[model samples]
Target: KVPTWTFHFQRSKRQRDDDALVLPQNQKNPKASRIAYKIEEYNPLLDSSNITPKDWAKIGKDIENNYMDYDGFVILHGTDTMAYTASALSFMCEHLRKPVIITGSQVPIYDVQNDGIENLLVALLIAGTYDIPEVGLYFHDKLYRGNRVTKVDAESFGAFSSPNLAPLVSTGVNITVNWNIVWRDKYQQRFQVSTEMNQNVGLLRLFPGITATTVRAFLQPPIEGVILETYGSGNAPDKDKALLDALKEATDSGVIIVNCTQCLRGTVSLTYATGAALKKAGVLPGADMTPEAALTKLSYVLAKKDLTLEEKKWVLFKNLRGEMTDAAGEPKLCLSDSRFIQAIAKSLSLSCTEELGAVRDALTPSLACAAAKTGDIEALEALKQLGSHLFFGDYDGRTPLHVACCEGNLNAVQYLLSQGATVHAKDRYGATPLSNAVHFRHKEVVELLRETGAHLSRDELDEAGVELCSLAASGDLEGLKLWILAGADLTKPGPDGQNVLQVAQSAGQKEVVATFSSCS
Candidate 1:
């Protein structure tokens, strides 16, 4: 039987003068203020792989119980499932205001040559000193956002890395914290541990010749959700009608199937025909989320008894808890992609310059979109000078203007607008520059797009953002969650001339503010 995990918050304060607080000169941080802490060694402590949601709840509860007393927390966990635990706690701790750093060393703490002590000391320092307000994983001197990390290696000291996002802090001679990416909650919500987790979620990794019976069996009874790991960018066998039918049937029966990529670093955009076919069969894109995050998120989301199946699906689409990146229709590429080889072969085979030019033209839209995303005007200018159409759409029908708005690149957006790029151009989702700006929380981009006469009709969005501020100001928690569930642009200013977050803060509606995370 799995041991029952519990917290023992035995308190003892120590000062710098006391010999009890002694540490090596190199291990200590001179800049950090004096901190007091207590240690608890759990009875029958298990390896990280043995940890469960119950243990996660206990950790979260322990943090919440001592939130006011301590500046931050450091969990000395095992490396095997450190990422999983970190991701779980990130979701479990609602409206956190302090650092919860999890770290472990590949070399055991008892070993003569060990990385454990150094990693532990740094994590403790960071937790006690920095104003990091999110769960983080500290490994090999780097502190990464908890949910974004994965175990990349077992033998190396650098056992973990956040593939899609950068580390929040790094430690050497002087600690460097990436304040720009740190999560700061605007609304001072009451902290709580959400212990409710439904473990009915399943994972189905697709391989060649995966049978229909296997897919159907995996989706059967009591399984509320499934993370369908597919080929590059969420593709599966499109021609296999029986296998497709199994997925279609599961989705049709209200089983939430999220399409995640097998690739370590990439968003699951349904751009290819294979991916589009899955979309048609009702598979939701699990954008840039690791399987561990997706699984835990499913357990957390599906456990919300108040949410309908559709509402759960909506939650999956959102970038909640810093678990995934909202690519916002940006052009994704790799230099080593096979398409470049195909282009070279086609160029060699074709004698016509115009046909070669057609291939060049076809590739330019993606490059232009990429430039717009990066706010690189020089690249955009070069592409334009080469007779590339700045207004052309990429694979998902997103133009350079849309990419600019999504990235909050004000200068790029202005340049595109000035150069006759379509201001009202819509992507495959019927989201224009204005819509992308509002959805992406780009306040300046939203204002500029509106000034350029881009309007959002009622049908364009799941919910009109106008009433969100009013609901927020009134401290209506359900109303706030409803709007969030309906997929309203929470970052957009309401008809009352204030955004929901700002309004919530002004009215001191902490709970209402807690319902939605900060846009960053």
Candidate 2:
């Protein structure tokens, strides 16, 4: 049997390690001041991997219970799933007019050289001092819009990165906040927290050889919503009619399937030819939102029993909190604008001149990425002439070529190709420009990259036994023979963790069963 947890309000309150619930110290709930807070610890501290929606709801309820008592809130969470949690809370907490910053350490706080102390301190300081009314994440002396942030590192102090947007605040000798971008609610709506979250949501990242049977199984029953992490922009394999048929059947039966991108940045427009098939199959475009944001938002949205399926889909696409960049509810800044670029250069004390070195320094990778996303060819050409390497990634490790491919900017892509950008260069998520192009369904860009011999490995699908299971499900005996001839493992479990033999048997493919027997 597994051990149960004992919840504590303070780290010091627990005399018995076996107790189920304990309260915090009286001193922790004193009158409000800078960095005023209370410890709400869970004994047998969970690695964030094990944190479930139920726990997320409980935290939301806790915040709701003490909403007005505190100026702002700080959640000391594990590194893993912190983004997921933050995104969930961004939805759960409606009309938030006070900061709710989540932060944690790469190294344990008890250890020397830990980021915990600084992270916690800054989180509290920002929570108390700032009037920026939204859920943000603090790490390594920088603050990001919560849902926009992703953990780009596993070992470094600089563990998180906001791929699409700049940091909300950067702390140095002085803390600078981008007030133009920080979300503000002027209507003075009351802050309310929602603990209601539908648990029947799923996240599926597509691969080259993922099967219809696997998709059907994963979305089998009791699943209300799914976040389909599609290829570049918002395309899936249009050739896979069976997979499309399965998804069509699901949405026809009132299941919400949101098309989210597997890439780090850009919107899921579902505008390409392949994306047409997905849209016809009842897929909704989840524009430029991270998978973490999509999944949690799906859950939070699905919980509303009052709303119809159509209304729910509408809500999903609508920019609820600044999560969707396409229909941004907040003010937007463009790097292509000379005044904005000048302002940024002025802040860095750099001259906005023809001096290539100064111009190169001013042309940050993030700014270049933004330009690439919007197909600003002028900026690309200028950066190219300034001797800036298109391959150089920002702090988040996103390259210009990848962003261009994601946005399907043919000119930018061609220019980068001519400039000799590495077609196989990977971002923090191991996604190459080719993969990003394919993910976004940039057919022209994909073709261009392919001409330069840019290709991604199909080993993940083969290793997961998708090919065998898919062939078995479809009774493609000849195909199975070829795969097995190339040393495919017939005894291997399928992508859903079921054996290939069992999958064939379940489908009543007698020929496939016999073939498996012969292979054995």
Candidate 3:
């Protein structure tokens, strides 16, 4: 029952007229399709049509009419104006209840590996049957509310993301829905579109030694609002009276001046005296809102001429959807909820739900060194919660599985694995979970890990770094045999250019040395 439309606009011939035609390869061969629209190109955000306003209006009306008669709508739009179109649709389409999902791919439909098919398939699925409507955007396996999406990465296929908003849903082998977050307004939740945007909104990124003349021109009579990209978590130079005076003059003339941070995370607070000056001048903080979100939100709020200016301010400060968090923020605690742990568990191919607590419990070891050092089952559970924090300070580093294997904590080892730890994890030293256990003298831990088919030998460690050599010098015969049986590379030499047999000899363990010789 879902109604879908593919709105394709012809690229304008004039170079300067098509402001939305910001594709990467602009060159066009006279005979073939313009290189700009060649879908095989790397950056799909650039592959946008240079549609004129008249054409867009026509397309919008056509889709809107068709949408009223159908259950949901999926639009195949050019990447360039996608965000703008999303913002525009948030107001333009009236009483929209069913999904009005917009999507585009990095490559054209003609390419063999074109991402268009997946994007289209997902969009159709969302529009065709998915409940909880409101304008939305779906692309590269993630669904975002249309109002919150922004095109960030130009080169990658997953170019668009709603940084201010959590994804409505994500797709893999099975589509996962974040049911709690999806928006559903009960009263009068029907399609009601309006298209009265005040094009007077503008953005200004402050730079060193900016002149009053530049600020004054944009803020004067014509513009109704201006978004100032401020420094740090929203600080402007108090030292510069010219900038301050210009901002004051603009706010005095009834133009709304909004302050937002140039940083990705964190909110804008005018905590400093200098910051106080900007707020005194009537500048408001846009707390954690992305520039794109700020711009579109401003456009959306301004479009509703029905709301008073004060009401607009109130709406901007609070979250309309899941666009922004609080003015102050903290690190996302890995253990507070088992959802992420559950996701990690599913990814690691685990089956038990009752035992899933072990993984969530293990995350605590990542918080404090003592929590992990205690060697208690609770401590090990805490460590599992620490997740990636155990192996590396940043999220990109090793997970808790690395810490357990490195210390040879068998309980922690089993818990991490059962909870969906990646057995193939390598620390900065490139040592696998099995390798770390062997080197750390936890023979039982190594044997248990070996059952999971973890990589065990030198060839497997061809890129195995120097730090792992020190662990191998532990002269663990049982650990070494466990690895050897699991298809370890015999040709890989240690730092001293010694094979496993030579490493055992150098470690002065006769029993280990003999075992290595027999294995060969």
Identify the candidate with maximal TM-score: 1
What local lDDT score does residue 321 receive in model 3, on the 0 to 100 scale?
A: 45
Rank all candidate structures by their TM-score, best first, as comma-separated numbers.
1, 2, 3
How many pairs in model 2 have backbone atoms within 3 A of each other, for residues 3 or more apart or on separate chains, i.e. clashes?
6
Give lDDT for model 3: 0.60
Please name the candidate that would achieve the greatest lDDT relative to the true structure: 1
lDDT tens digits by residue: candidate 3, 377-412: 575454434443332222324456666666777776
| Shift of residue 32 alpha carbon in model 2, Å | 14
Span of ten consecutive residues with least summed lDDT in model 2? 1-10
Q: TM-score of every model?
A: 0.60, 0.58, 0.53
Q: Per-residue alpha-carbon lDDT of model 2 for 1-520, expressed as tens digits?
A: 0111211121121232354223223353343222334566656667888888888877777777755344457788888888998899899988665678888888888888899888877676666555566888889999998888888899899989888888899997677777546764323234577788998999998999999999999887899999999898898999999999999999999999999888988877746889889999999988888888888999999999899999999999787877877553423233334565566667777663544344555465776788788988777766544445555677656788889998999988877666545554556555667667654556777677665545542332235387678778889776666444333478878879877788889999998898678665
Candidate 3 has its poorest 10 consecutive residues by lDDT at 33-42
Checking candidate 1 for backbone clashes, the offending pairs are none
